[model samples]
Target: MAMNLPSQRGRGRKAPMADINVTPLVDVMLVLLIIFMVTAPLLTAGVPVNLPDSLAKPLDQDQKPVQLSIDDQGRLFLENEEVAETDLPQRLERITAIQAGGTPPQVFLRADRQLDYGRVMAVMGELNRAGLNRVALVTVEGTPK
Candidate 1:
């Protein structure tokens, strides 16, 4: 096998490549961006439920709101963790106590469409008794019928 040798003109060496190839970097960034985009919606809420559809406008939120979910079987979930009815009032009071300001924290209540009206009211009553009066019902956006 014949070996190739460096040329001896002046100092025999090839100068290091000064230009950076950004194509690989851009490709990697775009791949990461796509991965995040695909997974973002799935990460938004932990519990799954069949929500009623409504045409109401979405509310503007300045701070993170509390998530209170009621499943079809009438189970309550506060921030994805299950809590019993007897313990709900105290838990809500704790939430209120942890707030930094006088204004009560906003609560977004997500109830399954198949749940009984009274069951929803009972949970809402617990929230009311705990001084968490700022509550909004969460629903899927729907087209006008």
Candidate 2:
């Protein structure tokens, strides 16, 4: 029986080469995809309102309308930024003043389902008194459960 010795090893053997393994990259990409899928729905802007649905198609405005949210606590938010009730009129005036020369700026009200109807109406009235008549209610698109 003949035994191979280390000194008799072939010199034709090549050393292992270094390269980036893409398996980890693929795994990270898949994880990122899953994270986005889970969070995308939560990124939408709106008060938690069980909006009344209608068969009518959604309306598209020429310019981005101002967003006003009324939460269950009766707090008012202008474009996701909390606004003092007293400052609302002044803010609306300023916003409308900027667009005075152009088309009247529209106001979209997103009131929580649990909010008082009177509170929502008062906000609309304030906007109207501030000379912003192009107002619309924001609602989801589905039948009430």
Candidate 3:
């Protein structure tokens, strides 16, 4: 008697895959790109001010200085902290005293366009009295005449 046998389709069937799907990765990357494009302009430093124009070139330094601002109301701020004018010299002196190996901290001054020049000069004088000589005036670039 002859026996009937079933035929095998191919040599052997492939094993089930164990790799992860990557469709979600492409979607996440596109979302991140769009978020960065929308938020890039909002991360700039310095508050918007109508700075006085000057013909002088911007001062260049190795390290960025600590920013100090004087508003139109004659209010003083050190990095956004409200500080009394009388306390400025003491604060600056303390900062300089903490310097390692006698390296003085650079101080940059920003005065409002409508602020009195006398107030600005007084602040400069106080910084000078504190032995902090590395100071520069901050200004906005003007349009070409």
Candidate 4:
């Protein structure tokens, strides 16, 4: 006397693959990388200053930076919002306090190429006066031949 059960078909076939196929994953990552590479130059800050081109090395991305933009007409902007020249120091202090927690604030200064050299210097002087010592001059990197 024995109990009988229906034998399943293909019972001994190899189990469904447990290994993940990484080919598609790699394909997706490569596509995303190419997209970022193509679009990165288009993503520069929106303030429309014609930055001077230079060979200077770029800043490290790990440090947060505050933007200070000077337009062709000598208008000042803090992160794209118009700012008064008279209010710069207090604004720098406030911004530094909020951003860097007492370390000297890193300011990326962008000035139009047509802007007067003296005006740029005066503005730099203002930033230095406000104790923002870590100033990075933002420039348009020239494309190579």
lDDT of 2 by residue, 1-145 (tens): 9964444355656445578899999999999999999999997785565556655568987888888888888888898889999999999999989988987788888888887788989999999999999988987777755
Identify the leading candidate in terms of lDDT: 1
Candidate 3: residue 62 lDDT (0-100) = 80
TM per model? 0.89, 0.69, 0.71, 0.66
Query: What are the lDDT scores of the predictions, listed in order?
Result: 0.91, 0.84, 0.79, 0.85
Report how far residue 58 has shifted in candidate 1, in Å.
Answer: 0.3
Q: Which pairs of residues clash in candidate 3, taking residues 3 or more apart in a chain or in different chains? A: none
On residues 17-85, what C-alpha lDDT tens digit does candidate 4 reach at each position? 689999999999999999999999887686799888887777677667889999999999998889899
Clashing pairs in 1: none
Segments in model 4 whose C-alpha atoms lie over 4 Å from true places = 1-43, 99-102, 143-145
For TM-score, candidate 1 versus 2, the one ahead is: 1
Worst 10 residues of 3 by lDDT: 4-13
| TM-score leader | 1
Task: Tell me how far candidate 4 lies from the true structure as C-alpha RMSD in angstroms.
Answer: 6.7
Stretches of candidate 2 off by over 4 Å are 1-20, 61-63, 114-116
Candidate 4 TM-score to native: 0.66
List model 3 lDDT by residue over 4-63, tens digit each: 444365346554568999989999999999999989987643454456777778776887
RMSD of each: 5.0, 6.0, 7.2, 6.7
* lDDT, candidate 3, at 92: 85
Screening candidate 4 with a backbone cut-off below 3 angstroms (N, C-alpha, C), the clashing residue pairs are: none
